[model samples]
Target: MTDSKLKVALVGCGQIADAHLGEIRRILCARAVAVCDQYLDLAKQAAARFGVPGVFTDLGKMLAEVRPDVLHVATPPHTHRPLALQALAAGVHVYVEKPFTVDVTEAEDVLAAAVAAKRLVCVGHDQLYDPAWQECRDLYQRGELGEVVHVDAVLGYDLAGPYGRVTASDPDHWVHRLPGKFFHNTIAHALYKITDFLRDEEPRIFATWFGALPGTDCPTELRVFLQGADVTANLLSSSAIEPSQRVTRVYGTRRVVEVDLDGRLLRQARAPTLRGPLVKLELPWRQKREAARSLRRNLWHFLRSRLHYFTGMHRLFTEFYQAIRTHGEPPIPYAEIRRLMAMMDQIFRSCRANERLSALANEERRLNGQPVPISPLDPPLTTHHSPLTNP
Candidate 1:
């Protein structure tokens, strides 16, 4: 544990902030010094629950009076850019939630602010910390999985009950009142994970398909064509399921791996050897169980699976601590996050236009004045094209 404790301010008191608070307690070098929210009562509640002494409804005032070392922007997506810019301008490290901003343009502005302030700016893409995903990525990098050929990821659930109502609420409601679109909130996590694993070559969308959600105007389906590793990645999400589930599959030349969202179990299948038509092997789970035993062990695994939940908060505090101590970039840098925002914009545009959108490649060509090269890992753009039908 670090000897110095970093003073942290949480800017939102929503449901996700509770998870952030938990992580803050876990990190011995951090303390929640202040809380801010549009709702004073909510802010007060968070402060009381977390043992924070300062509470305010205005972030500007909190920055002025408390001058927190780090500001955690846990507010809605639309407010992410402004709040993050404010924190960066104040010379405070910022940890903003996913979909960093509503649009790529706003994302660029956030990046510029971070560069100008010389302060670290990290976005919450916490799933990268999951042990299972980390293990899979490590193996892939070691050439154990061979060349990744395809990726199929699904992030969706049925929400026909109370959850459905929340998703279908008025546009003014915090849940539904996004400045840009809902895809950024829901699918960005999966996309980030996908891109992280396939970082060698960037994937461009060749096509998109969409569906309807009962209560909301959000697109329910996004089938994207990745034109790099001869692969296709399909991302499907909906607010219409009874219970939610997330699964990711990576198909490689030598083996196939599947990981559930919680990262509890990672199942893999390798190519057949000379023994017969097929030879299958599984990771050593029995040995894993023997290595550790206790409630804390299981709880830690559970925490690892939901690591993304606390990423923003953890990053916010960690960056602030690092900024004051070492003066370096945060865990998540701004350039990579800008790429994520741009990728999301392309995905949503493809979904809305009912066609494969080449926004990213087009932008690259416009900037560099060169024809985009084919991505070896992505499927051919012209082969699997399913365009979205605009409403």
Candidate 2:
């Protein structure tokens, strides 16, 4: 291992590239030596903003000249595999953003190339490493949550937000071209949170896709049900939900742990010991106390300049650099990466099947002079009085 600080380079100067640049600056052991993008102006702008020394329009040139120890691939999903393979071939470790590849096959190819090059690669499942999620993980690992009974992972998207607004308007946006469309690009942040409890490699998945927002043809809402060996999980990715959030609630025999990724808060709810009315009163007070504690903790972190929105990204980069220096395993295991990709493949397949069957059923109803069934997208998931509502 080199005694000098690790040199990092980033490719794809999009919105996520800014995140990588900002977080890399926070890691004392690493520095952004170079930035690259197809658009020379974007690369130059990022380098200037981040105080990066090297800027390039060509990735090969950057790899040859700057020779960074790590490369952050912040490009679109389809470009991840090739860019990563190129970096690995040049003896550079890779840190890719979520939806590591378009599909499982591409994921395997990149991982295999990394093994052949004797380098390491990590996917940017940042939400799983958030501080609140870390606390939830610790509780589950220490058996404080007991055996997991069920899990709910919710990722709310705001169509009116900066990125969403652009994607909704741009027909040629990269996200629209992906196989699963927006779901492929974003649902990973939600699904990865539940993978810890639903460890079955080949879980039964039932997924439905629908358009919740009035936008392009692509669906804006996704509902997925996964049944693993002993645990079952539900994942919701909705752009219609108000005040969008990224939350995961794990229900165990002994307790319930909810990690609010947006607010960076962790709360636990336990079965009431008191009988009848007292139990209801005590529960609300206990929840209030937990919320207050979370508020104070976040305030302390904020004072220390550690409560930034991308703190999870900063922590992940720090750990990955440490792993590279020590030749240790990455923060996320390769098996987990493959597992996630495989699950996505199955879920997307189910979504397609659902669409096909819906079309057939609707046609049959029309021929019989009956009213057409409502598509899943016709109404928001929130309006449905289903068991999926958080307990």
Candidate 3:
């Protein structure tokens, strides 16, 4: 670690910026030097909150004046590409928010810019730092669960009544009008976790589909099938109910592991019994003993898990800092992010078309120089006229 703290510029003062700010405050090797946003007041607010000396409505001005070592882009989906490219071109490292960009083309552009500039670009897939998921990955790697046959992940929430009303009133709010669905918003976390366990093997989207509920603009249920290393996984998301829940279930021949949104893991497998079958069945001694053992195991795992989780968090920020220092690749490579964006495009198309869409199929068509088929049911792209542009 270097003795001098790195100067960092925060672009876009949004909800997510607060999380990054919290982490930056804890990191002794980095300090926020400036804040920027199109909305000058928002930028001022962030700068005041963080005690950053510089605030600007223009990123170029901030870059020129602050000469920050790193630029954290937490803007809306649409602004990510342009802002990140600018930062990279200015020879500054960039850390971007999730859904790297609204489209794969944009992601590729950003990646190409990074490559040309020899800068680092890291996406905020922070869930990878969660300890519970790390423990699950550890177990799988140790072969305690055998080969992962299949993975089922589901994330859902209720956003109809009050939430919908509020969002409707502020449709331009990035969260409300983000280019994609909850799958794109939440699945990245699950995808990152699973990819950590299955490294080097690129996951391909086999199918993507969605369904609707009675009263929601978003899909009621979203499903995606991914294949890798002869293993297939299904990711599902829904917004049809209250008391939101997230779960991941991985099945293997030897045992089944269940993980909740918070990364709690429960493993079930058959073990040798000491007591007679009749006695064990009637008294359930094995069950009792296993439960007690599980409690102790969970506590020990929890402590270790917390440390690992925070360590991963530090690693992520550290990588971002080093990327700024050395102009190298990030922990989560841009190629992976491009793949994610491509998969997300297929997901949105499938949801809109109400049919299974294949990302590989589209890529093949594009590679062959064939025109990709368009779905008639797909939502029309939103159109907006810029006030600064002449009619």
Candidate 4:
């Protein structure tokens, strides 16, 4: 809450840090004054590359020296909690990366810290602010999509992508050690988009695993079915034949809106207005018109990307900084973060239980000298309508 420009410091100098720094630069009221990493060289490199004036190996020392108004925690999921708590305790606002913390309990702890410090905290559920995703939300809010009857968030990955291939080859990669493994690192991007529309508290989740490429370092494929009070959602993560994909679709009683995030496409499909046999004659033109309009909007966004690539992130940070300065609500509430972590905990537990059951069945087959077939395990949990809103 300073009248002058807010001084910001970033603690993690990873790949995502580049986006954070870029967005911070775009904020006229804030500047990234210092950068810190445990490895001094990494910090120095980031400082040099980004022209950050101050670099320090020790977080506490850096905090004492500059005392920036906000600290961005861009480290791995495992390090988020401790680092965030440290910043909160020092009376500094914090903007954390997603999956907020590794688990529900830890997320609650961070929330408690924010409460005690009387500061604001926000998570990096940046997809909710993405232009395409927000456009879909707007349609639903405007009642164009009607009540959300069902939601689908699909994430497609290439096991051979540069980062994916590196993680797959290195069993000791930090990603493999996460509680939910590959799913934890990627599933948040899927769940938050659907959760944005779901207001039900106590949602029931049943998950199934498909080891499409079994030899990968971690489970690279998963499907979770979630049922809420009145809305149902499916979260799918898989290493499919496609190179990559990130899409979220909302189905309503009136129309359906599908957003291809990676492709920057948003399309809506509805039943044709014409009736009788003549309906077929007019439907094709209407469909083509819809497709053409979507392409036009997506292409506009693509051209704008040349100026600012992380537009969603830039918007998120700008709103977050405004909250800190004016003492308003955070861009994303803590209660939402709590609910998200609870859902992740459920997914991890269910997936682990499924894995254990499969192992037992495989052992039984070996004991009987029978062949074990490659197939997905039967989902052990049931999905039911429970309007319990935990957040």
Q: Which residue pairs clash in candidate 4?
A: 201-388, 201-389, 201-390, 202-388, 202-389
> Which parts of model 1 are misplaced by more than 4 Å?
1-3, 158-164, 174-180, 200-202, 206-209, 229-232, 240-243, 272-324, 355-391
Structural similarity to truth (TM-score) of each candidate = 0.77, 0.95, 0.74, 0.91
Cα lDDT tens digits for candidate 3, 232-278: 67776666545566677777766676665443444454444455677
Candidate 4 lDDT over 1-391, as tens digits, reads 4588889999999788888988898789999999999888888988888789999888898899999999999888999999999999899999999879999999999999999999989999887888878889888878898878899999888878876787777887788788888888788989998898776665887775666334554777898888888999999898874767898889999999889877667878888778898788777787678778867876776687643457788889999999998989998988899999999988777776667666676777788797775666542223322222222
Deviation from native of the Cα of residue 370 in model 4, angstroms = 5.1
Q: Which stretches in model 4 have alpha-carbon errors above 4 Å?
A: 212-217, 276-284, 298-307, 365-370, 377-391
- Separately for all candidates shown, the number of backbone clashes (residues 3 or more apart, or on different chains) is 22, 0, 0, 5
* RMSD of each candidate relative to the true structure: 8.8, 4.3, 9.7, 3.6
lDDT of each: 0.68, 0.88, 0.67, 0.83
lDDT of 2 by residue, 11-51 (tens): 99988888899989888888999999999999999998999
- Give per-residue CA lDDT, model 1, range 207-279, as digits (tens): 4544445556554455565555555566655454435667788888888877665534566765444344222
lDDT of 4 at 14: 77
- Tell me how far the alpha carbon of residue 381 in candidate 4 is from the true structure, in angstroms, after superposition: 14
